[model samples]
Target: MNNIRNWLMGILAGLATVFLTVGGVRYVMAGGEPGEVEKAKQAFKSAGIGYGLAALAPLVVTILRGIVGV
Candidate 1:
């Protein structure tokens, strides 16, 4: 059961990573005008930062949970 749960979590994480990466790339590609491109570029940068924060969130949560014995 634990292994199955782990597998599901891993799959979800992988999919999230793929979705964010592809979405960022697609936004950059679909930038139509100069202003739109700039907006997309900024969004891509923010998404990258968000991705980093999201990657940290689980680790942090796990650590806290372990510490709290939750």
Candidate 2:
């Protein structure tokens, strides 16, 4: 149970890291192009969502455990 939780946490953290890195690169390379800037903003939003999910994973798992009696 704990192993699974730890694995999920790691995956979510990795997703956030990847999105953040991509967003940063895009932003730097956008060079004031509005379209590119919008895309970069989307990547940043995705990164934020991933981070939020990672932060909530433990709490969510605990809730599931309670409901499922795991």
Candidate 3:
């Protein structure tokens, strides 16, 4: 279970990193276009959410485990 938990956390962190990197690249490549900038901003927002979820995953999992008596 510990191994599985670690694996999931790692995957979530990796995905968050990927989203953040892609969002940053998109922002940089927007070239001052308002629509593109908005899209890039949305991507950045998604990345932030991903990061927040990833950061919270361990705590969430622990809480769940305790609730279920794992």
Candidate 4:
């Protein structure tokens, strides 16, 4: 169970990093194109969400543990 928690936290953090990098690349390559810019914005939004989830990973693990009686 502790290993599961650690894995979950690591995965979430990694996803956040990936999203952030993708967002930055998209934004930089957008080149003022409306559609591309919109996509970049969405990517940034997803990155924010990923980061938020990463931040909440510990709490989430705790809740899951409680529900599972671990």
Candidate 5:
């Protein structure tokens, strides 16, 4: 179970990193076009949320494990 948790955490963290990097690239490549900028901003926001969720997953898992007496 601990190994599974570690794998899941690693996958989520990797995905979050990918999202952040792609979003950053999109934002940088928007080139001042308003619509493109808005899209890039939304992507960036999603990346931030992904990163935050990834960062919180371990804490959440720990709390859940404690609650379930795992």
Candidate 6:
């Protein structure tokens, strides 16, 4: 059970990271000159992915804690 919980946490954390990073990159790129808007968008996407991961970390931690009965 503990092992399963750990695996699930890892997967969830990874997903969150990817999403937040992508979103961030897109958001950042959304700025800048209109011509470079595309490039900026890409960066913002990454940034978003990072943010998502950060948000997910807490949830993952909580689940892990529960699994360990802590």
Among the numbered candidates, top lDDT falls to 2
CA-only RMSD, every prediction: 4.7, 0.9, 1.5, 1.2, 1.9, 6.2
Q: Ten consecutive residues with minimal summed lDDT in candidate 1?
A: 1-10
Question: Cα miss at 5, model 5 (Å)?
Answer: 2.7
What order do you get sorting by lDDT, best first? 2, 4, 3, 5, 1, 6
The window of 10 residues in a row where model 3 has the poorest summed lDDT is 1-10
The local distance difference test score of each candidate is 0.62, 0.91, 0.81, 0.84, 0.77, 0.61
TM match of model 2 to true structure: 0.93
Clash totals, every prediction: 0, 0, 0, 0, 0, 28
The Cα error of candidate 2 at residue 38, in Å, is 0.7
TM-score of each: 0.45, 0.93, 0.81, 0.87, 0.73, 0.45
Give model 5 RMSD, 1 decimal.
Answer: 1.9
Candidate 1 lDDT tens digits, 12-67: 56666665676567666774766656666665666566556555666666776679
Per-residue C-alpha lDDT of model 2 across residues 1-70, encoded as one tens digit per residue:
6787788889998999999999999999999999999999999999999989988889888998999998
| TM-score, model 3 to reference | 0.81
> Candidate 4 — what's its lDDT?
0.84
Q: Looking at candidate 1, what is the lDDT of residue 9?
A: 56
Write the number of the candidate with greater lDDT, choosing between 3 and 5. 3
Highest TM-score against the true fold, candidate: 2
Clashing pairs in 1: none
lDDT of 6 by residue, 26-57 (tens): 55666665645655565556556655665566
Candidate 5's TM-score reads 0.73
Error of 1 at 58 (Å): 12
Q: Stretches of candidate 2 above 4 Å error?
A: none
lDDT of 3 by residue, 1-70 (tens): 5676777778877887887888788889989989888888887788788778778878878887899898
Q: Show model 1 residue runs off by greater than 4 Å.
A: 33-70
Question: Candidate 2 or 6, higher lDDT?
Answer: 2
In terms of TM-score, which candidate is stronger, 2 or 3? 2
TM-score preference between candidates 4 and 5, better one: 4
Model 3 vs truth, CA RMSD: 1.5
Better of 1 and 2 by lDDT: 2
